[model samples]
Target: MDTSASSSQVAAAAVAVAMALLVPILSAAAGGDGWEDAHATFYGDETGGETMQGACGYGDLFQQGYGLETTALSVALFNEGWSCGGCYELLCHDSTYCAPGGATVRVTATNLCPANYSKPNENWCNPPLRHFDLSKPMFLRLVTDFRAGIIPVTYRRVPCAKRGGIRFEMKGNQWWVGVLVFNVAGAGDVKAMAVKGSQDGQWADMSRNWGQIWNGDKRHVGQGLSFRVVASDGRALVLDDVVPPAWAFGQSFEASGQF
Candidate 1:
């Protein structure tokens, strides 16, 4: 339903290769052998009102197909905002409100659970503390009681399992290009991005602007587009001619395959 991306930033994306093989190297596993301790709370109602927009730069969550299966990560797990789009599996733990032997919920990291310095000790999202601020629906799936407010939980990183191909939404103007990368699979978090225009056939390196958005300096109007995307684990995907020559800013494009 929607789109955006990252850098591997502050440096150039020097590993991009055009016409590379389709092979995707298995990502280095970030998931742990056992669950890690964490805490969770719910935000927004069942309609997911407040959960729609986020710090991840993602647009309408439902329109982007993220729906309610999304969460805001504590600063510790947010990886300085690069963790946007990463997937996590969570299970209720050691809480009376937990659903008995319930299946774990898998959610994407779509926002940041900011720490309140004024209430440092009371802030679960403070640095060095792993926490999840989940959508009300997602949190209720784990806890039997919505009134519990917060619940102890365990979680682990997991390969994202997105349906269909990865999506890209073009943002910004002709002077600069901002792309929002979403619906990613595999390592979920993008490490680097490069774009090419049919007219020039030259790749322009993009830097992590913020959240899941990447920015580049070149202008490629009225040209077919290709993309080079690298995941956090070093795997890469090359999408050739995914956007037509007539593509315009704000239009979303889907590549043929995923990483």
Candidate 2:
């Protein structure tokens, strides 16, 4: 009755299913552990090839929604006249995620709350809650009122770019800030990312992260960049340990010669 061949086929199918489940777990074990470095440029959309360069470690000032043409995010050691070679590479960016909604806005976060709720968890749709619902096409800057927890009052000057969202303004130079996203449920690949800057971005920091949405830490205490995740399940997304690392970079000239 060809029983042996049929049994072999069933075994093979079982093996395939096992392999599929094992792949994600194995990849997470190998890649999403500890602190890793990521590049400043990544695709902010689902096109898979559309790349967007990150702003300097300080912040990005966009004229509109579209992306910069060829301006790669500049990077160097935290020193005057520093170049890319032999630099410490402060932050490593994870290009794995751009926007939760797969939009053209690059990096985006969720609101993490129901419409009836008075306040949102965080602007990025990340809260300490176990479950959340996500609005599609999340943007990177859609942060929550986390200033009370992680940010100090001295650095609490929100940027105009923030508009109605959460954004920070760090006045000093040569400091680096970072943003990261993690898989809280440990279902998908988690990642941590950092962005470095020195002397107001004469030198630059990159981004970094883990495999899943877990806890994160940064050297800079001032306000940091933002990232987001979809809302679901009982697991929560936490952003913490945002610290500014000391750094220095070359000087710059103003058009008005104010200096």
Candidate 3:
């Protein structure tokens, strides 16, 4: 398996969760819920295809399906210091699937992967979906090599209406992700932000703390980051389990970790 790609996928997954957190703040400012940004679909159950179950929002619907589809893929609280390397199967289009000895092959779909692409609708099941077991808890960042033509299908986010008091896992940390995104094309700035507090398993209250990562500059136009929870209450936060958020966006190049 391509460790770099797998790692990138893991990292990008975190940012996707983080990106979902930005949708509400952006939508509230825009005075409307922004679900028309692109033609995308979310899936819950996995048989190696991105199927739509006709649900609204992003990750929330997907998580619901996952719980019913596969126990390993279900949403739960990851304990601190849980470690194990496991393998799972998934289907993809155009991407090569190979595993080295002792390597865990995790076939997944990122916001940038084509296998997870789907038409925009209120369905919970759609195309371009993936299924697998999360081996560890860590915030992941993904950066695609667009130069190689591995472009993301489109930008996506979780609907704010669904993210109230819900938590998800990313970058090895558990967090209540907000569904939102930033528009750099018109605004010319997409700054990275973080949710504060140990309010695990709870929705983020916007009237709280936010840490800025970037300030919409030329460097971050086509790039993004996801900050995972590393330290909470002055101790390193251990991720034994995590729940996926209600929604999130996909990306090409991604990274994971806490700031």
Return the top candidate by lDDT: 1
Per-residue alpha-carbon lDDT of model 1 for 14-43, expressed as tens digits?
444421221121111122455677899988
Question: lDDT tens digits, residues 15-47, model 3?
Answer: 999889866544433335531221212232233
Which stretches of model 2 miss by more than 4 angstroms? Answer: 32-259
Q: Say which prediction, candidate 1 or candidate 2, comes out ahead on TM-score.
A: 1
List the RMSD of every prediction in angstroms.
16.2, 18.9, 22.8
Q: Write the per-residue lDDT of candidate 2 for residues 21-103, one digit (tens) a residue.
A: 77643443344433222222222333212232222222221321222221121112111111100111111122333222212
By TM-score, the best candidate is: 1
For all predicted structures, in order, the TM-scores are 0.85, 0.20, 0.17
Model 3 scores a C-alpha lDDT of 0.24
lDDT of each: 0.84, 0.25, 0.24
**Lowest lDDT block of 10, candidate 3:** 77-86
- Candidate 1: regions farther than 4 A off: 1-32
Q: Cα lDDT of model 2 overall?
A: 0.25
What TM-score, to 2 decimals, does candidate 2 have?
A: 0.20
Worst 10 residues of 1 by lDDT: 21-30
